[model samples]
Target: MNFNLLHEIVLGFMVVLLLVAVAVIIERFIYYSYIERSRKRLLGLLAKGDEQAVLKETKGSSCPHARLIGGMLALKGLEKDAFESKVQALYLTQQAGVKRLLWMVDTTITLSPLLGLLGTILGIIDTFNALASQGVSDPQAVSQGIGTALFATAAGIGIAVVCLVFHNYFSERVERINEQLKVMALDQAGAVAGEGSGVRGGREPARIQPQAAAA
Candidate 1:
């Protein structure tokens, strides 16, 4: 097979991955932002400390933070172990959700440059082959190889950088959300404990009234 052909194939594959990475990055960014907003809203509601209002506001919410709060509210005199278990479960669920499509993004970041390098090597080989067969008589033939090689390298570098930036941004955002969740869980756990010792007395947690539950 011709080195030129192989090089083009590798470049083609790199282009495909770049396209997929762009799509995934945009999707993940939007989804994560949505989750963050929902979490923030839940936290804002949680801060009010009105048991009925929290449940009412969070009713039908799908945010992991809201779910965690819900679990906390549900437990009246239950052991801390049960609440801890819920916390762990919520963390795992949030982690899994945040990581959706991250592997593809990471793979593109790692593979793009390697593919570009492979293409560059093949381009060099093609240039040499052209020079030998055509006796350096055709400068255009050699130049074409060099151009293709450089093009692939530039494209790969560009793709990799974008992916890396996106991955880092997402990682930071996930960490922030998780931290907020942990803090809220601890605070609410304490509140639940304190209230458990109050007049509520191990009864069912306060529920949102349907009339006020409309979001």
Candidate 2:
């Protein structure tokens, strides 16, 4: 194999993977920021039965949580079973949205180390080839191959480590958002059902208390 081309290819791929991972990290952070900011207020509006208010808050928002809450609000007046069913469907849809682009990060995590290992192998091969041809008379060739091997190995490991941290963080964020959506749906459903029949699950439906958005 042409070690030079192979080295470049490995390095180029690693760079691309790192860039993609970083982009995902930034995008998810921004999205989570929006979701966290609007959560309390939107739930409060739902609790108050202020459809107009909730609509206004969710206006133009792309957050799955926002859209999920808005969808739930529109499904008001449904019977308990029907309401729960619809909410569940909406929940699954929104959950899918929340998971968007996450697979790329996962790909980065899995591919980086393998690419690095390939580079390392290529580098060692080049070193042996250089020494065999030149009998150690050409120090530069041997050093060049070793350098390629080390750089490729390091870059691959570094990218994987960074992406792994973010992957876990984003995964946890998804879980938390999922939990929040479940609570909001349950509360909104209970409140609506309670209004119709004055009870839910053998008791008054839980209400979402209003709170100020985090600073």
Candidate 3:
């Protein structure tokens, strides 16, 4: 087996995986920044039923939290059940978006070491086969084969470690963001519900006053 080409392909794949992980990291950083910036202010607007301001502010955002605010704002006068249903639908969409590209990280983490192990085995096999054919003519040949096997083993483990750390970091970050958005949606919905209750309670006194006057 031609181990040089095999090693080259494996290294090239690891390079691509590294680039993809970097992209995911940067994307999450931007997304998290946008979400954090808008959260408090947008929720405040939802509480006040200031739909216009919320819409205007959140118009250009791609963050998932902004969409939750939008969901809450859209249901400004809604009953609690209706509010929850809409918010839940939007929440799932945000969860899906947050999880994008994570599969690639997992795949890279899984494949890197397997490929390295394969390369290691092949390197050792080729070395021994050469010794059988050429009678172990050069001491350097033994050293070169051992070096190849060790390098392949190291490369695989290294890729697995790097990808695993990054995957965990990004996945945990997404989970936190998802939970925060869920809380924000429910809080805003509860506020609207409370406001609705207050309005109904205040009208009851007037309703009774008019009936008493008629009687």
Name the best candidate (by TM-score).
2
lDDT of 3 by residue, 1-95 (tens): 67656766766776776687668667766766677777766656655656577677668677777776665566667665665566666667787
RMSD score of candidate 2 (Å): 5.9
lDDT of 1 by residue, 108-136 (tens): 99999999989998888888887877787
Query: Tens digit of lDDT per residue, candidate 2, span 1-215?
Result: 67867878888988988988899889989988878888866656655656667777767777776787677667778777777677777777787777789999999989998999898888788778767777988778678769868888888888889899999999999888877776665555665543642212232444332221100
lDDT (CA) per prediction: 0.71, 0.74, 0.67
**TM-score of each predicted structure versus truth:** 0.79, 0.84, 0.78
Give the runs in model 3 whose Cα sits over 4 Å from its true position.
40-50, 77-80, 191-215
Model 2: runs farther than 4 Å from truth?
Answer: 47-49, 193-215
- Would you give me the overall lDDT of model 1? 0.71
| Candidate 1 vs candidate 3, TM-score winner | 1
- Sorted by lDDT (best first), the order is 2, 1, 3
